[model samples]
Target: MLSFARAEGAMGAFSASGTLAVMLDRNAAVILVNEPAERLFGRDLWVTGRHLACADKNATDALRRAFHVLLRNPTPPAMLNPVPLPRLGGRPLLAYPTRLPRITTKAHPVR
Candidate 1:
């Protein structure tokens, strides 16, 4: 499995890979994108704050539903295959929704 010490590191790795990669937050908003992904999607604009569903209205409803399910139950990653990319000649693509590790906080008692 691919691992990154930080989100920036992950983005750097993704940018280096030839395959398209995208990282989304629990809210389904894009958090990271790579060069291949930008070329595949044919846009140079910033996508970090944009929701994936905004690209294709036909899949918006279903994508939102899947996002909700993933948020509710995030133990195992969710996969969405054959996703239609209307902007890319309606080409099908695969998407994975994985949960990011949470940071724990604990109060320490002073002696």
Candidate 2:
């Protein structure tokens, strides 16, 4: 499981790399997301009941496949290519799934 400390580290890596990050669970539900990622949601993309969603039908279909690959990949590479999130306007966002370390951190309970 990706601990909160690892999540923070992942977020830092994402920021340094100029990429927005979204972490999903095995069932494809949104576990957590960085601020930059939440801002990416507007017209083309948004969270539909804790899952990433797309306004465009084609993009939605594409995201479904990407999510499957992301969730079910058995090998270590996780994903060989970044999943392309198509937007109605502006450049498409490339999503890369990463595994965070297991180190834990104390924090307030989820309210």
Candidate 3:
């Protein structure tokens, strides 16, 4: 498993592997997003002012719930159950959230 000892390493690996990864803050605002994910913007997904969103109400609800799953659950979920991305054509991509370890930024240290 890739570690976020440094965000660069994990983000780089995800980019190299062609995996779409979005790092979200407690408020569901995006902190970072991979290249593959950028393609999703203005299509199925939207990142307005650092907050990720979708056009479909159901999809948006699912996405929000998925994020909360990570926040509320003591144990990490094996998967976010693969929520489907909206599509105009082709198979929809599945979106899932993975919790990062409580990484302490220089400004905030973990106890």
Which number leads on TM-score? 3
Relative to the true structure, candidate 3 reaches a TM of: 0.76
- TM-score head-to-head 2 vs 3, winner: 3
**C-alpha positional error of residue 69 in candidate 3 after TM-score superposition, expressed in Å:** 1.2
Off by over 4 Å in 3: 1-5, 105-111
Model 2 residue 102 CA deviation (Å) reads 7.0
Tell me the tens digit of each residue's lDDT in model 1 across 27-80: 777767777777655431234338664355565556667677667674645454
Candidate 3 yields a Cα-based lDDT of 0.75
Better of 2 and 3 by lDDT: 3
Ranking by lDDT: 3, 2, 1
- Give lDDT for model 2: 0.71
Rank all candidate structures by their TM-score, best first, as comma-separated numbers: 3, 2, 1
Query: Highest lDDT, which number?
Result: 3
For model 2, which pairs clash?
none
Ten residues in sequence with the least summed lDDT for candidate 1: 40-49
Residue 52 shift from truth in candidate 2, angstroms: 0.5
How many steric clashes does model 3 contain?
0
TM-score of 2: 0.69
Candidates' C-alpha lDDT: 0.57, 0.71, 0.75
Per-residue CA lDDT of candidate 2, range 5-59, in tens? Answer: 6767777787778777887767888877788787888887888888888767776
